[model samples]
Target: MNFLGFFNITTVALALMFIGSIGMLVVKKPIDKVILYSIVDAGFLLAVVTFKYLDVAFAIAILGPVSTIIFLMSILKIDRIRHNNREGGPNV
Candidate 1:
């Protein structure tokens, strides 16, 4: 099945990973990093699926978003703390 004209799922997954990695390296902002991270994460999940590891793919689908949320929450908390410090507010 020449879906998207690709040889196989592995090729598609690898291409995704390569593009995401390059984007991650090039992006400067933290939010952009997160977006790139999601791309890389999706690539990894696709790779898992390609290997016929449905269980692993299910786990990744469940945990990947959780990890991304953790990263986003941390970024928000850090930014808030920095803003507070800059405004002479309490550092709590």
Candidate 2:
């Protein structure tokens, strides 16, 4: 509504995005990145709700992490398989 309100929205959105990117890029651990990404998605959902985009927010809430979890699961599984090899690697 007001300039300050819009500025607040922008600042929040930017901060969330920046935090997400930092987590995704700077963190060496995959689990931490996934958690941060979920946080970022929740932040986005909050932003959308603030703008009265309830439908979009709901869609994001329902669908945002499905693929991410699937991918993470796959990666973990692959890591497990590799570690389970007979070469005496560390197990997951």
Candidate 3:
């Protein structure tokens, strides 16, 4: 593909990521925001791959899921805390 086409596509992908980040700021749930942030990371990966930046793409591919897993573990911990608190107090 032409570099020009790649540049255009990258612009679109980055725009989507920007919008997704804005959405995440207002999202109420931790898990939902994490998921949306992950999508934005995936969009960056897509742009890197499209631009033939394999090294950057590889790093993003490795780091993205690791972050997602960390976020998921945090969410699980939160749920556990909420469950523990729910026996005699307000819901989380």
What RMSD does each model have against the real structure? Answer: 2.4, 4.6, 4.5
Give each model's whole-structure lDDT. 0.92, 0.77, 0.83
Sliding window of 10 residues with minimal summed lDDT for model 1: 1-10
Whichever of 1 and 3 has more TM-score, that candidate is 1
Worst 10 residues of 2 by lDDT: 1-10
Q: TM-score of model 2 relative to the true fold?
A: 0.66
Q: Looking at candidate 1, what is the lDDT of residue 24?
A: 86
lDDT of 1 by residue, 7-81 (tens): 678987898899999998998888998999998999999999999999999999999999999999998998899
- Tell me the tens digit of each residue's lDDT in model 2 across 4-70: 7656775686678778877888888768877888768766777887788899978887888786788
C-alpha lDDT of residue 3 in model 3: 75
TM-score of every candidate relative to the true structure: 0.81, 0.66, 0.70
Candidate 3, residues 10-73, lDDT tens digits: the string is 7778886887798798898887888788778877887889899999889888888998888888
- Model number with the top TM-score: 1
Root-mean-square deviation of Cα positions for candidate 3 versus the true structure, in angstroms: 4.5
| Backbone clashes (count) for model 3 | 0
